[model samples]
Target chain A: MSQADLSIPFRRRAGRAMEDAFLQEALTIATTKFIGLRREAFDAFPEGEGLRDRAREIKEATLQHLDRYLEQLIGNVERFGGRVHFATTAAEARAVILEIGRRAGARMAVKSKSMATEEIHLNEALEEAGIVPVETDLGEYIIQLAHERPSHIIAPAIHKTKGQIADLFGKELKRTVPADPEALTQLARGELREKFLQADLGITGANFAVADTGTVVLVTNEGNGRMVTSLPRVHVAVMGVEKVVPSMSDLMVFLAILAKSATGQKLSVYTTLVQGPRRAGELEGPEEFHLVLLDNGRVDQLAGPLREALYCLRCGACLNVCPVYRQIGGHAYGHTYPGPIGILLTAMLNGPASVKELAHASSLCGACADACPVRIDIPRMLIELRRQVDEKRIAPWIERVVFESFGWLLARPLLYGLAGRIARVLQRPFVRDGAIRSLPLFGDWTRTRDLPAVASRTFRERWNELERETPR
Target chain B: MTTRAEFMARIRAELGKTRGLPPATPARRPARPRVEAEAIRAELAERWPEALERFRHELEKVGGVFYRVATLAEVVPVVAGIARERAARRLVSWHAAELGGDLGPALTAQGLEPVAMPPGEVASAAERQRLRELVAAAELGLTGVDLAIAETGTLVLSSGAGRPRSTSLLPPYHIALFDRTALVESLAQAGVFLELWHADGAPGPRGAVISFITGPSRTADIELTLTRGVHGPKEVHAIFVEAPIRG
Candidate 1:
């Protein structure tokens, strides 16, 4: 949780990833394939952009009246014969889940990919209670076996190579496994299948909680989540309070945008909605269904400009497309959520003061916001967080002085222009191939890209020259 | 209880309501219009022929076999074939009249029993429990795609009558028949289709879960290895049912 511990070192991770030629090849190949496939999915339609706009609008409307829908959701859940509990913190959320596990006398939990639970560290808490929790997402399950945290928001183990995966299987699953992605998936299925059958509890995250019918919509490519909810006698869904939308009409927007942005598909392979426990008329749902709605700093976000953070669908396309996330992978972020979204989420949830170090993780290049389907101005938010960090005086003295100097100079055009000319002249020593090379102050920025040289003639100088020649 | 708005007002008052952030200011517009939908689609189609080809290619990539049949009548024999191959006896199915008349009679003739039940009439835990047992025991779970996205070779079905939401899930093997005409290449088109059908109510899909299933249920739970059918339907049969050739 400390700042030093939290620096994502995305550039460093990316540098290492680049060095591992095999991994670089895998990542490039996979990312390229998926991005193209995603584009194709959108291309098949004439109204893709409009669909996204509609979806985003739906999402906004849904979240605007979220509280009302949450109430309706509670009412519907109760009416449908489900139990809903509200939690104010990670401890409370964990307590509710563990209590459910205890009451079920559950020894193991099979979990779907739910960032809310990860934010609460549900697995560690459950393990402390002497119950093992298994992650069933292909990416999550792989990382779980390695005892590592998720790397990307969606593609958790995107940084891992096929060989690393094959080795993990060979050693842990005790069989020769191929480097094939298919073989890897089959291995996970074989292993989780038994757990699904034996586990006493199913813990999942809700993608969207529809208030109209009290349905918990869970979308997954793998079937593990469905089993986690249905097979287990006790099903516990841990979701953020913001996850609930008011109606099915509102739910459509998220459903449309979520998978498209996340996996670049029309939809994932599986989307299941559970209304409540095995209704009197239903056959296969959990006997007891419990929903734990965690506030855990989201309420604070709702009150400020940072509320856009809540609108994040966790699609992870932002991270996939983010230059920063591509480099560090997910683990170096040192939080449950990773990438641009993870930085903001961890900062808000862990108490922004504690995560001031993460405030500078991104370049204000605007790609994260650009890739964001919900249109969250991520860079602007990061800038705001940076400002807060400085105001709180938690930012290091050196950084404070740098931005302060820049700010003061920018306030006076004359001073700024003079400084700019001076800096261009001073850059001779660092210039390599017309770009800065190995500058002492900020080497990371120059490490990959050539910092383009400032034009020889400043705009002011040219403007003055033109004025002198004009008749006026 | 106080009036609904009054109740909310009281909570806000008790909580010490204060003015919050100003509404989001609109950004300055770029001179050129952002590309329109048709243009984007045409660009996508032109620039991404290989990708478009791959989209359909990948559908067959992940253990999903999609058929491109012309008519709904062709649906019956395909359903019957799947049932016969699975050697299914008690079939738990959704309410698709097309399937019942076209496929059900064929299934019955083939000695494959098809029981199409109304969704959610199981009034007690015992009945519900029995239904769950049937899902696990049944040979094949049959249902119709509310809409299918060709770009990903996905089947979209929400729970309703005959589709005992549980029947589509929880089964070992599931065979879904979709129309090729139903296939839209992009999520944008998929969105429009959903919008068009938005108000056409089917129990409001209360607990209405829109499932966009691309292939059979799969997992990689053990050691970062892949396996199919961990929780939901293990084997999925997607019959694309392509539109019939014009004479």
Candidate 2:
């Protein structure tokens, strides 16, 4: 996201998305379709539930022994003649990759759809250094051409219409193009095919790095992942530390569930596992392979509060099921990642202060948890983040005061009853249609949603009346 | 730059703080993968007809074309027919040794330009570049499947001496030849084969990549409109030969 977009408060950004007629319809259709697809996928696969649990366990197990696994991964990668680079921060990651580009004399780099690379903001740095970074995935290519960040995790261009895409392509290629997906895709394929063959550097993100065999796995519906890794002279894979798995067996468990959760496929069209650079007899593959192990903020979360968030598969399922995301879409979240999980990730990456407003973005419906293939318990962590935000004084004074006073009143029955009566007396001016349309200093809440007027008769009053009327 | 030592130390520090958490272990791998794999192969040898039926159903479900032939020689006509339908004249294929036989001459006889990749690395970079251009320009790519997953109708191809990755990738149409030998019932069984392949150590003289291709490349990114042939083959064809090509 750009600094200008980030400057807008979350509420205004969300309001803008809500008011856009096209985006509203697109979100409804896309999320509704994704929800149905995911449901059908899991409903047919009876073992999906058990596999979810096992996948979660595998993630936990891997994290528990992360040091050892990473060590083994590093050793084996070297054994396979692949270099391993460590990046403590995003800057270091970009610097390492830029140095590699400089050494390789790379004029251009072809990149597959990799959130890791996006998270690190690698493209801007590469461009500044005079190396062209080409996003090869169809969705990513469209967004890259428009100079926009991805709005969705897997479907980066879901927010865009065919007409908009036609315009973008026409502008870039300087030719009139039709508003048809097939024609647009073919045009992109033709444009990127030459870049694939000509690029000197190929960059990707590992979906899972097998520790035992020293392999980096990439899952994509498009074949950009294959093209990037195979054709370029140098291939660089940027991956978070949490992406490593123990063995090939563990990888299968994930493969079965990942696509089912993301796009409801049994498996994506391509699951490419590249171990290292081209072998001696291999006709085509990168000659030099580099794996960059990134820690930016993931290392702190190993023992931190956001630990379970590490198990996220980047499937975008939570986004589909999230009420907030469905209404406002990914852009409102104002971060690299956007969804229920994106809030926690934003908190993890930027700090608790950054997500003070974002933490309250969820309605605590827990749909994200239920839809999660690994069941990350997103709501539970969200509540924790909210508490941390308040405790750290990141929340506004009014919110803290209101919540604290409510907690105090609820703990004392007499005070709660007294307060309810006082509130009913004070709410007469704003209470219409048995709901509060607006309230002094709380109009923000009532602006979009109605607050139920303190009941005409409190539940306690109704209980007392029932007791009195019952026969002895 | 973050040195390996400092990075490991930071990870250790955080890991040290995590204690008394719930116990968990990774998925259990097959204890003796080689033995287990052989047992699976033997079991599949008997039930291959059912597996093949399921594979065909699933493959077609994902927009793949399937063919059944009585013998390896019968696959030639099917390939020619596919080429004729698509008007694809140029083809690149794995080496004769890797493909189990040389179909190049027969394919050429059918009025198609067919080239086979060298079995080993080319001695010169210029020659390698030339072969890459050949694969890139060719409309049809032919290779052999290392494993054909019945559960998802996926064809697993491991890159190696004769099998250049682009033979199935760069071309617009990918046709893979396999028999009961490569058929596996599920991804779990495929896992066993993978474990067995890498059990002792690295396999001898192989490429550095293995691709599990479920179908042709597709995307629904633009307005959620599904489109095929984004960057990989637009059409994938799998030919099942009843008689083993190796025999």
TM-score of each: 0.78, 0.98
Question: How well is each residue in B95-181 modelled by candidate 2, as lDDT tens digits?
Answer: 999887899888889998999999997889999999999999999999999999999999999999889999999999999999899
Candidate 2 residues A370-472, lDDT tens each? 9999999999999999989999999999888888988998999998999999998999999899999988787788899899999989999999999999988
Candidate 2 - chain A - TM = 0.98
Cα lDDT tens digits, model 1, A144-200, are: 877777766666676677788899889986878898877666567668867876789
* Candidate 2: clashing residue pairs, number: 0
The C-alpha stretches of model 2 lying farther than 4 A from their native spots are: A1-4, A468-472, B203-205
Q: Compare the candidates by TM-score and give the number of the best one.
A: 2
Off by over 4 Å in 1: A1-23, A412-436, A439-459, A470-472, B1-173, B177-214, B218-235, B238-247
For each model, chain A TM-score? 0.91, 0.98
